[model samples]
Target: MGLIISIIIGLIAGAVAHRVLNSRGGFLGNLVVGLIGALIGGKLAEMFRLQVTGGILDQLVLATVGAILFLFLWRKIRN
Candidate 1:
């Protein structure tokens, strides 16, 4: 199902982001970050009118962008 696939992608993206960003969190935290990132990425893509395919690679790309943005904001706010 689409939902299931999305969740899997989110999880993977979260893990990748956490590792890349050196974020401190467990699996659930990573998942939350990834999910939020997905939402942010989707909105950003829409705002910028970016065209990305509905595939795993596309999701990963969006999630990475979202995660980067989230991490940047998180650091700024935490400071």
Candidate 2:
């Protein structure tokens, strides 16, 4: 299902982002961040006119980048 795939992608993306950024968060946290990151990444891609094909790889990359950016900003804002 579409929803299931999205969740899986989100989890993977979040985990990857957390690993890359060396941030602390559990499964639920990663899922939340990943979903939000996907949204942010989608909007950014649209705004920038980036051609993101409907592929798992593309989505994963975008989501990971977005998650990293989100975590980075969150840390900055919190501190």
Candidate 3:
């Protein structure tokens, strides 16, 4: 259940990040990036003491943060 929810959130977050960053990728690629982003973002928030959880909106926000950060880093590395 949690995994399923995370996947959905990741998908949405990835899509949002792609638009924000003007990045390109297919659905599967986005999902992978999104899942990775969620992990990264979760850890980052943890270090910063951000209490995120308990709601879809909270999860989405966390995932989005992760996705954006991941995309930014990837872009920097690629360039």
TM-score for each model: 0.87, 0.96, 0.90
Count of backbone clashes, every candidate in sequence: 0, 0, 0
RMSD of each: 1.2, 0.7, 1.1
Against the reference, the lDDT scores of all candidates come to 0.83, 0.91, 0.87
> Can you rank all candidates by lDDT, best first?
2, 3, 1
Residues 1-79, candidate 3: write the lDDT tens digits. 9888888998999999998999897899789888888888888888999876659887788888899999999889999
Model 2: lDDT equals 0.91
Give me candidate 1's TM-score against the actual structure.
0.87
Q: Which is the winner by lDDT between candidate 1 and candidate 3?
A: 3
Tens digit of per-residue lDDT, candidate 2, span 1-79: 9999999999998999899999888999999999988998888899999998979999988888899999999999999
For model 1 the local lDDT of residue 30 reads 75
Best by TM-score: 2
Error of 1 at 49 (Å): 1.0
